[model samples]
Target: MNSHLLNGHYQILKLLNDREDGKTYLVEDVNFPDSQFIVKQLRPPSSNPQTLTILRRLFASKAATLEKLGQKNDKIQKLIAYFEENEEFYIVQEFISGNPLTDEIIQGQPLSEDQVITLLLEILEILVIVHSYGVIHRDIKPANIIRRESDKKLALVNVGTFNEAITNTVDNLEYMPIEQVNGNLKYNSDIYALGMVAIAALKGLPAKEISNLRSQKNQLTGEIVWDNKNLKVNRKLAKIINRMVRFDYRKRYQYATEVLNDLKKLINVEDDQQKQHHKKLLLVLTGVVGCIILGVGAWQLRSPKPGSDAELKLYQEGVNKYDAGNYEGAVEDFNQAIKLDPQNALAYNKRGDAYYRLGDYEQAQADSSQALLLNPQDANAYFDRGFAFSQLGKYKEAIADYNQAIKLNSKNGYAYYGRGLALAQLKDNKGAIRDFSKAIALKPRYTEAYLQRGIVRRRLKLRQAAIQDFDTVIKIDPSDAKAYYQRGLTQSINKQKYVALKDYTEAININPKYIEAYLNRGDLYSDLGDNVEATENYNTILKIDPKFIPAYIHRAIHRFSFGNYQGAIEDYTTALKLDPNNITAYNNRGNAYLELGNKKAANQDYSQAIAINPNNALAYYNRGVIRSKQKNKQGAIADFQKAAKLFQQQGEQDSYQDAQKEIAILQHNLAPAPTTRPKSNNY
Candidate 1:
């Protein structure tokens, strides 16, 4: 083949380089004689038509993507054309008249930290656009980067990955990451090569010599150890470089933006902070100055460190804010205090209290536990932890912590109140009432204690006494939304529907965004068969918070009740995807599936509910019915027995009897029992 005018309208000026994948050449477009272009020849090993066909398609697609990128980014080389000549694919690219970066990155001459940082910023600017398009530039070496002659701005060349050529002595392989070399190119692979280039420049090592200069290498983990201490680079910059070139791609910066952000932080923020500013005084001084120095020396020996005053001030400010009921502001002050002095137990405890007030129970528990770690005997911290546990439904743990708090400080009325709430959740109604009474006795105006005792009273079916307790709480704080909500629940249970509706409305008026109030009001409307009102309430919940899964579930139940099985199935499926372990979603979705005559899908859902929670007796019973219908007699009997045992253990007398009846039917090998109805985790 002639090197001149190899294609109909192109001429090869000179061969630029050779590699395993293909050859790149300096070429000129014969039609546009005033301009020159770079042409890349794709050399596939196999001459088979099928192999070449796939390669040609991939080549054209990559060329199109590069053209798109070049249109948006001036730094990237523009795609001129791509064509097939003699069964070989060639990509023509716009030529940049410039000096290669290899000229600046000379061996035996290390670039300074500032210079390397600047270089990184320039390269990363191009990469941000490249990576955003989900395209990985497999080749990012010094020779591939060009400092344009007209302007000093660097221009990127060879943007496609098809130029991958991994050979023992190949210069490209020096900068190519292990993942890229193995043909699994990640977005970070380009970052890794760019990092390697920076490392080589900073170490005064050539591409070939850089590989040999590894002081330590973990072959298993693929950690590359370059000398940061011996070089003049900033330690922060060095760490960034190391992270970019980690052996495992997972450990590397997953995005160009991430690496760029870290580099920017290191350059912009840490650079100025690297120096310490202080005043130096002369030793030559008068008697007064000497006395002052001696006094300061003694104070330094006895007083807290320089930053202790600031920490104490912040803690005091946090306490003041907490007293003012500004929980958010208190949290901000406590955060600063903690940052100033992490070992301050008081600050952590105060922050925990603020978090508790904000209803962040998990964070409250964490901070209170940290406070306890610093000072285990602190009764307030113990009470805080107990309160968080109670809110999170860890009733036993809450009780245990409350026990500790009471032991440490017998006058801790809040501890007793917290323990009462936990005992109420555990269904120990009498114990909860007793604890609440003790709390009220300790603090005569303990309104929360009265409120919680009311709840326990209602659980025990002491309706009049529960109402009296709620009346007392209202007397103490007439504006309490929770007190009204609890009363509404009690009235609803007593069949006072209109009264319950009024109480729910009052709660909502006091706290317009009260989710429980909205839920209960909607439920009452649903019970009354007022479809329009119920729908409005549900829609309001969704509009307020689309991620409120419980509202979707309620709407699904309403749909199922009205015979819209398909709509119910879709809603339940969405809920299940968001909360896979939700027993209500599984059981109800199974119900919807069953009504749709999809017994197979129903059986799968019931099985899943059982898998998530083995003690779910309803799920076991439902699955038993499906198995019996499918004629798996022994399997049905086994499931029924399990359901009966669990139902009996849980004190569900009616359900247990039903399960036992099913077990008898299955054991006798007679006709299957009636299908078990779905259970709900109700409002």
Candidate 2:
């Protein structure tokens, strides 16, 4: 193509790529020489008149929708102008300049998991806008994503037009089944392609190669497996992708809006893990690497070349011993190496690694610090130091070392993952997720990443998405009892009691000694009104761990429900013994005493509970009842009024109303004495 003007204003510059529907070209505007654009020349499909018209209508409808949607999100490339020239339709859009995610992966210099997640979130936000306008991108792959050179953020391009144009041909349509061949035409199809892109980024493989791994008969299963293994980024992310790419359209996400919501949740989870991992990596890099560098420098400056070589040799031997799990031998060899070559960084690093294995974090940190001083650029030294720092709970220093390690080697997924763990310890969820995502991008089969990300997601209140992540964990490691337990907890919170029970049972079956599972299952049983089952579960937990206070409390509540006041009191007392500040136990015990007609005991218990937690309106009401029974009408009225005020403050109208009723009764009984009382006093 010539560099001359085309369509009056667009001057052809260079061809970018050719697609089934059109040729994409980089062009400059004749009127504005500095402006650049991507001009797509659409070739109308040669088909019957009826089919051609339908395709044209679809294209026009999609184009119009895109124009409306483009105004909402800045992440999408905007279409500028469209016109018909020589019977061929052409559309001009903003030209985005940057490398594709595919290119980055192929160059073996892919972005961190955090970066990938950030980009995906940006795209997802754009999808939300596009889908809201009843338009699907229909194709979303790495090639369609561009990283802006100026901001380093991602943008979506080459969307909404080409798929319809290419698939509109009558002859091609007759041979290709819409459901089988045109599966990529729907919104979820785009999501499927995006998942493939994510998998490719994680595994450093092409998307088509992963697709080929799926058996024709069990395509969805293969996708799930590959996505789970490669993106071990998080369980929640994998599940979201799995849902989006479901073979059954009905089972897939019905709208891009749903996918967007899921993407936000996944982003949050991954971000938290990323931050924690970054911190741990920092600590290791600084402490371990610093020590190794210092030790190495000291060894190199030692007198006698022979002695230095011998020391180096001894250090290497020590490292080998450490690698072989002979920690004692390794320590002996490292000491000899240090004696001969006092500044051997490698020797220090090896010794530190050994100490770490031996659960001597302090010694490990000391050795790692010496190593880092000897070789500032040593990534391994930094990593070891950070690990020691994290083990010692020196999280801030650990994070700093991880940052240095990442600066030296961006592909260090372990460092990022470690940092995420550290950040999580500090309750920096957002930062942790970011580091976790980076780790996932670097090493997709990182099962720990998924587990951590799922936990963070749950913390962020993304319950449904968190459940999806737990499901991924289960798929990756079927024997993961913790995953099952966590998923059960989330399901229970979401009110899926049956599903929660099943997950809890699975967890208990896998690890029969899981006390938490038994306790949670007991709570679930109680929620379902299965008192017998609930009591049995509580008893089971008590058998395993008798000191479990929550179990005692639950059992007490169950006893009280069954009118076993004495048993309830006994259980409540035991619970209080286990945990002295158990206000619930005090309150429940007071109820039991009241039922037993021990007004004084009931009053004392209620007063104690109220003293412990002044905001306990129920305790006040109960105490008021006791006072009324004891004929302290004024005291009872005061307590009832306070209870009503407290209930009203808590937004409990029903409880407030009940308190008011009691207050009214007390007021009627304490009504002013008639004037005859004065006459009696005078007499």
Candidate 3:
């Protein structure tokens, strides 16, 4: 099937392997050659249509299992698609291009102690998820573990599903646990294999030879001794490995995380010991105070301490670079500062802030964590880490850090503001308002806090209070386009259309590139029945930034309201091209297709939207309407029930009630329900 296109997209480039079961091909997208995939084809015993149908069902069932596993772990190769074509089944998955561990672990040429530790840790990380899923990778050997070429991350491939069981273990005797050979595979079975791999590396031999070495076996138990006196390995690591490869499966680590924790502890202990040794040596060598009193002019240098002069110089340079927006340069200077004085908490805190600016939240979190370790009471370090956590979507952790910062310094307006943001994400609007109000009390002219509080009030239906917050912000800084735009939103909600139009106009005039202001102005004009002006506003936003998605969505919504269904479809289509997973565009376009009576396309769009965001109540409700039209009563009721449940969970009481009404109608009256237009493009 070379060069044959499958799924209307993937074209087979080259056959990777041909086995008794099927053939595996390296395929690339017809439109994008660089987007590569591996397609596995399953061949039946004969071309009987019934047998082929059964084979197709089996392929799809197993594919679903692999797909679910793919979503829960980043270290596992992803299952992209599974389909049937020309009476053959195809399973497409992400192609991980890398050599196996066998290439790196040459027999008789052992890896360094650190190298082996790193490999064990990386593989164990992947196994942690695999084991958590209650699945055992019966085959855990060097050849099966791929070290990714791009990032050097170990990605586990060829996972055996329940349908495609891996029963063969004759050649992998060295890596297979004894219990696994007897069909009793525990989670720690993989741990035994990994430990054997480590032992093989330490002994400078292949795992097969190490497993069968009679000389290394215990005198009575027949268990192979793992560590050797000649092997250069840490005592702690050796002990951990011994427990991992215990002859009794029950004696080994019961979980991968247990082993991971122990390995991390060993690393931490080694680091602390090295640091202590260096500190003691420095103290002995830098005792120059007595020499200076004895008139020994040769003793000119002294021991470095926290915030030493050299470190301070580098720290100041880092601060200047950070202020100038040279985050990478600031990080370099801070690295030097920390190297010169390892205990410089100020340097670490500043570096964390710089990393935050550079959009490296993980590094920012790490540096801030180190700063907190050195100076536990540092409020700024807590705030910095909290800010990083907020960006990383760890809202609860961010709130805890912000709470600590506020406890250390109650006057810190930034802490209150950050805590408010985290609370808002967690849907605690009242708590967010309280924090925002506290922030405003601490800094009366804080525009961001006022703006956020105004938005929250608007969401809570306190339009007048929200308007007042916007007014205060505008009064403080008249040139603030965002404040004027927010005020316009409140005014629009309060039915002051003309006043809202003027506010949007002022916002646009102040910031000529304000896309949201343009969209809102367009919406206001549309509400006023000024079609030409509304279209012009949306067109202006598109002209400013052709790739801006909101402009297309707003224009589509405007066209739909004016009964221009085809124009709306065109705009939604363009928006989807810019962002394939734009749930708003997909759902709205589905509505347009439904209006045009293209039920198939509409169903497809709704299904795609639901696939992208499973909690999409609107998509489910709309699909229910279609199913009702098609006289699928049971399917319609099921969809309506699911939609109602999701709507209730999402706090859309009106939509939830509508969905319940649909289900009742479908169940009793058998009448088709009206379609809903959800606030898909809320902005």
CA lDDT of each prediction against the hidden true structure: 0.79, 0.72, 0.80
| Candidate RMSDs in order | 20.4, 16.3, 22.4
Please give the TM-score that candidate 2 achieves against the real structure.
0.44
Candidate 2: residue 211 Cα off by (Å): 47
Clashes of each: 0, 81, 0
Clash count (model 3, backbone only): 0
lDDT (10s digit) by residue, model 2, range 1-683: 57566798898889987867668788999899889998888787665677667766766766676675556455688888777676567788888878776677663344566665666566765665555455666557777788888788788887755456535432222112134354545655555556556655655665455544343335545334554443446556656666765666667776554665566556554564464356445644565555586664322212225546777677667755764458989999999988877766666777887899899999999998887776566676788888899998999999999999899899989899888988988899989989988998898767678778878878888887788778777665555678889999888888999999988987776566788999889878877889888898999998999898888887877777778899989988998888887878888788888778787788888889889988888888878877777788889888889889998999989888888878877788864222100000000
Q: Mind giving the per-residue lDDT tens digits that candidate 3 earns over 1-683?
A: 65567889998889888877678889998888789998877665668878666666666676777787798566787899888777767778898989988787777898888888888888876776566455677667777788899998888886655223311223367777788778777878889888888877776676557556525779797677756677768877888998988889988887776787688767766764464355345433443444556665443223345557787788778866765558999999999988887876667877898899899999999999997776566677899999999999999999999999999889889899999999999989999999999999999989899999999999999999999999999765555678889999999988999999988986775556789999999988987888999999999999999999999998898898899999999999999999999988988898899889998898899899889999888888888887788888898888889999998998989889998888878778755644444334443
Model 1 Cα lDDT, one tens digit per residue, 1-683: 24667578888888887777678888877788868899888776667989777777777677778888788677888998888878777888899999988898888888888888888888886887676555777779888899999988898988764553211223377787777777677888898899998988887777778667543686676588785466666666788898988878888887666776677656544432231010011111222354586674321111114668888788768766765558999999999988877776667877998899899999999999997775565677788899899889888999999999999889878888888888888888899899999999998878789988988889889988998888787665444668888999999999999999988876665455778888888888988888888777877888888788898799888777778899888878988888888888898888889888899999999999999998888888888888888899888889889988998999999989998888787778778745555455553
Top candidate, metric lDDT: 3
Task: Give the TM-score of each candidate.
Answer: 0.47, 0.44, 0.51
Q: What TM-score should be assigned to candidate 3?
A: 0.51
Q: After superposition, how far is residue 315 of candidate 1 from its true place, in Å?
A: 3.8
- Candidate numbers sorted by TM-score from highest down: 3, 1, 2
